[model samples]
Structures are given as C-alpha cells and as structure tokens.
Target: MGDFLDKRAEHLSTGMKQKTNIARAVVHQPDVVVLDEPTTGLDIMTKQNIIEFIRDLKADNTPVVFSTHHLDEVALLCDSVCLIDRGTSRFCGSIEAFKEVGQSGELNDAFMNIVKQGTMHV
Candidate 1:
C-alpha cells in the first residue's frame, strides 16, 4: 500500500495501480462498493491477491458490486449474481439458482446456454 501513500499512482506498476484503486475505493468504509473488472489485464498472482482482498471485504460485511466476464471469479466470490445480456437482465438470483438452470449444473455451461439460447427461464 506504500505506492498509494506515496502519491505515486502514475509511477506504480499495473498491479500496484490496481491495488491503489481498490484501496482508495474502500478507504472511507463505504456501505457499498462498485468495481468494474478489477482483475482485468492483471497477472494470475495479482488477480488472486485482489480476489482474496475482496473476500476480506466480504468478511467485514461490505457489499460489493462488480461487473466481469470471468465466471470463475463469480463462482468463487459471489453469493448472488445478475447476468445481463445486451443491456437486459436475463437472470438475477442466488448462485444455487443459477446452477440449477444448467443441464449439468455448471456455471460456465449455464452462462453459455443463456448467451446462446436466451431462453433461460429467469
């Protein structure tokens, strides 16, 4: 977090810049936080660290709203999910409900089906 305190956002590495962005977002202890693809373009290790940090936020009872195409991250971190297609909310419910919609009860399969068929019954 030194890069954040030092006022060196421009000089920071990509991963560090990402961390600084997360830090600033949460510094005020807001009731809810919104992030758009926080892990996009990050290395695997950095992505994992950011995921862990998000878990920490959850542990502290913070509500996080993030948009991502990374289904694996959703499986790991989300209790509920909202799937949108072409500016429409196709599904919004618990993870279990989403899994139940798939033929194989797999998130990726369900997501693909939703995108391809657009017939997921809510």
Candidate 2:
C-alpha cells in the first residue's frame, strides 16, 4: 500500500497533491466516487488527464459525482447538469435542453440567461 499513498504530500505541488488524492480515491475500487474541484490548480495537461480519468471511470460503469465551479468543465464532461444559485434550483436538464432554452451553444451563456431571468424559483 506504500505505492498507493501519497508520500510527497508535504513537499508536492498542489496539482501533485490533487493527483495523489485521485489515485487514492480510486484504489479501493468503489462503485461510486465523488470529487470536488478535482482539477483545481492544475495545468491544462493535468486537467485533461483528470477529465479523461473520470471519463474512463464512467465507461467502466462507475457512477461519478463531480462538483466543479468551472462551467467549461461541466459543459465538456457532464451529460446532465443542475444549476443552483442562491440555494435554488435554476435549471436541471441535459446540456442540449439547457442550450435550447437560451438558443445558444455556450453553457455559460445559458446559465447566465437562466439566472438573469430569475426563472429558477422552486
């Protein structure tokens, strides 16, 4: 188990620590995984690697719950998304449906439009 543990936590960079956490998280082979800001403070290459790893987990039939503040990441990796603002549900649906509502392909634009309209009550 020595190889599975992060030995460099004290000295490693933030991205390295994040990667180490990810490695540890998957080592147990669980059915579900929840990651919060898994790609935070990482470069583009490292972020891509993390994203791809999540994709692979999904392909293997593992249910992954990913929480991220990056809308672009959500747009790229999520099949369905629920946008919550001020503790209210703004939108809950597929990316395609969300895009249709705003008549735009950009997820951020759609999210902004929904928030602007204040249509997420309840």
Give the number of the best model, judged by lDDT: 1
Q: How many angstroms is residue 3 displaced in model 1 relative to the true structure, after the best TM-score fit?
A: 5.4
TM-score of 1: 0.83
Off by over 4 Å in 1: 1-13, 119-122
Cα-based RMSD of candidate 2: 2.8
lDDT of candidate model 1 versus the reference: 0.83
Clashing pairs in 2: none
Per-model C-alpha RMSD: 2.2, 2.8
Count of clashing pairs, candidate 2: 0
lDDT tens digits, residue span 1-122, model 2: 36635565877768777887888888999889988889998999999999999989989889888878898888778888887888888778888888877567888788788888878633
Estimated TM-score for each candidate = 0.83, 0.81
Query: How many times do residue backbones clash in model 1?
Result: 0
